[model samples]
Target: MKLAYIVALAAGLAAVAPASAETLLRIGYPGTGLDDRPFGYGDYIAIGHVKQLVEAEFKDQPDVKVTWTFFRGAGPALNESLAAGQLDFAAGLGDLPAIVGRSRGLATEFLASAGSHDPLYLAVPPNSSIHSVEDLRDHKVAQFRGTNLQIATDRVLEAHGLSEKNIRFVSLDSNAATAALVSGNVDASFGGSEYLDLAKHGVVKIIYSTKNDNPTLGRNSGLYVTADFEKAHPDYTAKVVEAFVKAAHFGADEANRQDVFEIWAKSGLPAESFATDFKDERLAHRLSPVVDDYIVARYKDQAERAKAYGLIKKDVDIDSWFNTKYLKQALTDQKLEHYWPTFDAKGQKLTDGEVEQTRAATN
Candidate 1:
C-alpha cells in the first residue's frame, strides 16, 4: 500500500499536473560492474530512492516519471552529453570538468559537493625510482587535460618549484593515463581516490596522494547540472538534490556504509578501506544540507591556488559557480537544517541518527 501510494504520487512532476508532473530527467551514472548500463544496481536503487522520496513527500501530486542517461567516467564522453542537452543531474565529476564545461558555454551550475574529498593520487609504476612527490621533478607526469586532476597536478608542481615544462604534462583520459603508467609510457599519473582500488590490487602505488600533506585540496566531488535544465525542471532538480543529500547521510552511517560500499566495490573497489579512508574528522561534520562556511571558503582557496598553479583559466570565479537554492529548499522541505557528519566516528556519531527533524505539515 505504501509503495503503491508513493509510486502513484510521483507520476507527472515534469511540468506539474493534477496527478503529478511529468519529467524527462537524464541522469549520468558512472558505468561500472553490476549494471553494465550506467544505471547499475546501486544507481537504479538511488534513482528509485529519489523517486520514492519525492513521491512520498508530494503524494498529493502523482505524474512525474524520470528518464536516465549513463556515462563511463567523468571526462570527454560526459562533456559531450552535456553539450547535447541530454543531461539534467550528474555526479562524481571534478572541478576541472566543471570549469571546461563552463568555459565552452555549457550552461551548467555547480551544486553542493557530493562530499568534500577529491584527493589526487600521484602514482608511479612499482620498481621505478620516484618514491616521493618531489621525486618527479625531472621526470614527466601525465594528467587528464581539462579535468580536475589537472588542477591538482598543477598545484603539486607549483608547490614543488616545478612547472609544466619542467616535466612533460601528457594529456590523457584516466584509463589511457593508467595504461601509460602501467606500460612505463609516463613517469607518473594523477588520479582520484577512486583509483585506490587499483593501488590496493598492486596495479600501481601511490607515492603522493592529495591526502599526503594538504588536506584541503581533497574537497568533495563536484555535483552539477545545466542551468537550462534546472530552469526547465525545478521540481525534478529539487527531487534529485534531495536524494543526494539523504544519501550522504545513508552512505556515511556505519550501518549503511556496507550497502554504499558494496555499490562502490562492485566497481572494482574494496568496501572497508574505501569507507575508512573517506571518514574525515572536521569536514565530515558539514556533509549535507548545511554547507559549512569553511567548505565554501575552501573552494575559494582551491580556486585561487588552481589559478596560481595555472590549472584553470584565471577568469573562472568559484563563487559564481554554486547555486544554494536547491540545497536550501531540500533542507527546508526535509527540515534537515542541522549539521551531520558525513561519516561515522563511533560513539561521537549522532544518536537517533536522524540528522534533522523533517515532520509533515500539521492541519
Candidate 2:
C-alpha cells in the first residue's frame, strides 16, 4: 500500500513539473534584520501583504503564480535583483535607492506612493552624554547607507547645522547597528520604529525622533514596476494596483486603526511599537497611495540632493519616471478620488476647497 501511494504521489508531481503555461509574477521588498523577517511594516503595503490581497486578485487565473521575495541586504539588494531582471514589481522601495537605480538606467515606473512621512529615530546608549542633535558632532554614528534612512539622516544633520563630515559615519545595517549600539561600539544609530522596542526594554535611549519635526526630514517609500513587465502585462499591473489601493482604503480608515496595527504586527514588530511611532499622526496621512504633486516634488528634491551628495552620478528625470495612470484609474474605479487629503510641494495640507478643485481638474 505504501509503495502504491508513493507511486501515485510521484505521478502527481511529474504532471505539474512541466508548467510551461504558468506565468510567475515576482514581487520584491527590502527586508531588514539578521533573521530576514518575511514581512514589513510602516505602510499600506504591510496591510496588503498580510491580507494576501494580491494573491486573491489573481486567484481565478490558474495560469498565474505570485511570489514575494524579501532581501536581507535591504534596498541595494532590491536594486541588484532589478538589475538581474528578477523582479516584476518592487513595493516599499525608498526614494534614495530608487533614484540611484533610475540614475543607473533601471527601466521602471513609479506606480504609487506606499508610505510617506515615516519618522526617523536616533538612538544612543543608555546613560550616554548626547542630549540633542548638536551633540552628534565628532561622535561615532552608525547609519544604514544606500537606503532612505541615509537621506533622512543627512537632512536631520543639515537641519542641525551639521553634515556627514561633522561625525564619524559607520555603515551598518539594522541588526549590526543595534548590536554595535548595545556593545558601546557606536555612540548612536539612525533607524526606524524597531528601535522603540529596544527603548522600551532600556536597551537604548532615543535622543531624537522626526515624528513631529519637519516633515521633509521624514522618509518616503513607494511601489514600482519594471517597464518590461508593465508593458507586457498591463492588465496584471492594473489589477495589482487596484488591490493595493483597496488595502490602502482599509488602512486609512480611522475606524480600522487597531486592525491596521494588528496586521502590521505580523512583521515581527510589536504592535505597540507602531502605535508609539505613529502616536499623533493620522493613518490617512501616512497610508495614502496617491502619487500626488508633493510626492513628485519630493522625488525631484531627493534626486537633486542625491546628485549633490555624490550618491548618484547623473540626474534622474523625475517627471518622465513617474507613471500615475494606474493609480488614477484605481482611485476612480474605487470611487475614492477624494478619500485622502492632498499636500502641496512644501508638505502643507491643501484646504478642502483646493483638494476639491484638484480632484475636479484631474477627473
Candidate 3:
C-alpha cells in the first residue's frame, strides 16, 4: 500500500513539473536602489514593487518565482539586457531600440506605455532663452540613445526642420543629461515632467511639450516583453501586466503622492516639484490594452516618418510591430473593464477618496 501511494505521488509531481519548468517572472525596469534610490546598477532594481505585487497575486502558487533586473538607464542597460536574453521584459525603451530590435530580429514585442497615462516633455535650461526645437540648430543637445525620449526629441527637431546633422547630439543618461544641462555641458536635453523638479530650483524649464508635437507621444515611452519568455510562459506575461495596472492605480492616489515622491526621491529622482503641482488624473493612469485609434494609424505613419527622417531601417507596419495579446488577456482575466477616461491636463483635480474608490472599482 505504501509503494502504491509513492507511485501516485510521483504521477502528481510529474503533472506539475512541465508547467513549473518554464515559469520565471523576469521583469526589467529602470535601475535604482531599494526604497527607490537611483544608480540602479550594482545596487537596486527600480520598479521592484511590481515583483512584490505579482507575488502577492500568486502567493500560494508554488510554480512561480520572480526575478527582476535593472538597466542603469532606459537606453543602454535595458537594450543590452534584452539583447543578451538576460531580460524577459523591460520598460523605458525608445523608438530606436524598439525599431532596431525588430529589424535585428531581437524577437521583442511592444507591450504598453509606462504611464499609458501621459508622457514626458522637451526641456531646456531654466536660464536658456531657447524655446522651440527650431531654436536648437547648431547648438549642443544631450540625449540617451535608444529611448522613446529620443523619439520625442527627434519629432520636436523634425517639426522645426532640423535633423541629427543640424545639431550636436551628445549621448548621456537621464541623470547625466540633467547634470550636464545644469552645468551648461549641453545647451538643452529632452525633458520629461520630472524636469519640473529642476525648474522649481530654477535650473531648467520645459521649452516645449512632446504633446505639442504629437498627442501619441504617450506611445513613445512604454513597457515591452521579449518573445522567448513571452511565448514560453505567456501566463507570466499576463501577470506582469496585472501588476503594472495595479501600480498605475496605486500611483494615481493623492495620498500616495508623498509616497510616490519618496519612491523617486529614493532613486535620486526630482519629482518633488512635479508631485507638488501634480493634481490631475492625466498623469495618473493610462490603463488601455488596446491602442488608441489615432495611435494605431500613426504606427505605420511614424515608421514612415522614421524612415524618411533616417531614424529606422525601413518602414515597417506598426501593427505588425506591436503585440498586445498578453495585455488584452491580462485585462480580461483581471476583470479590468475601463479605459482611462480622458482628462483635461489643464484643469485636472484629485480627490483622494475618489482615487481610492476608482482604484478599488477597477482592480
lDDT of each: 0.60, 0.88, 0.60
User: What lDDT is reached at residue 337 by model 2?
Assistant: 81
Which candidate gets the maximum lDDT versus the true structure? 2
The number of the candidate with the highest TM-score is 2
Which stretch of 10 consecutive residues in model 3 shows the poorest summed lDDT?
39-48
Better of 2 and 3 by TM-score: 2
* Candidates ranked, most accurate by lDDT first: 2, 3, 1
Give one digit per residue, the lDDT tens place, for model 3 in 141-198: 8877666566656766676788788989998877788788889899988755557767
Error of 2 at 151 (Å): 0.9
**C-alpha lDDT (0 to 100) for residue 294 of candidate 3:** 39
Model 2: how far is 273 from its true place, Å?
Answer: 0.6
TM-score of each: 0.73, 0.91, 0.75
lDDT of 3 at 43: 11
lDDT of 2: 0.88
**Clashes in predicted model 1:** 23
Candidate 1, residue 323: how far the Cα is off, in Å: 2.2
Q: After superposition, how far is residue 185 of candidate 1 from its true place, in Å?
A: 2.4
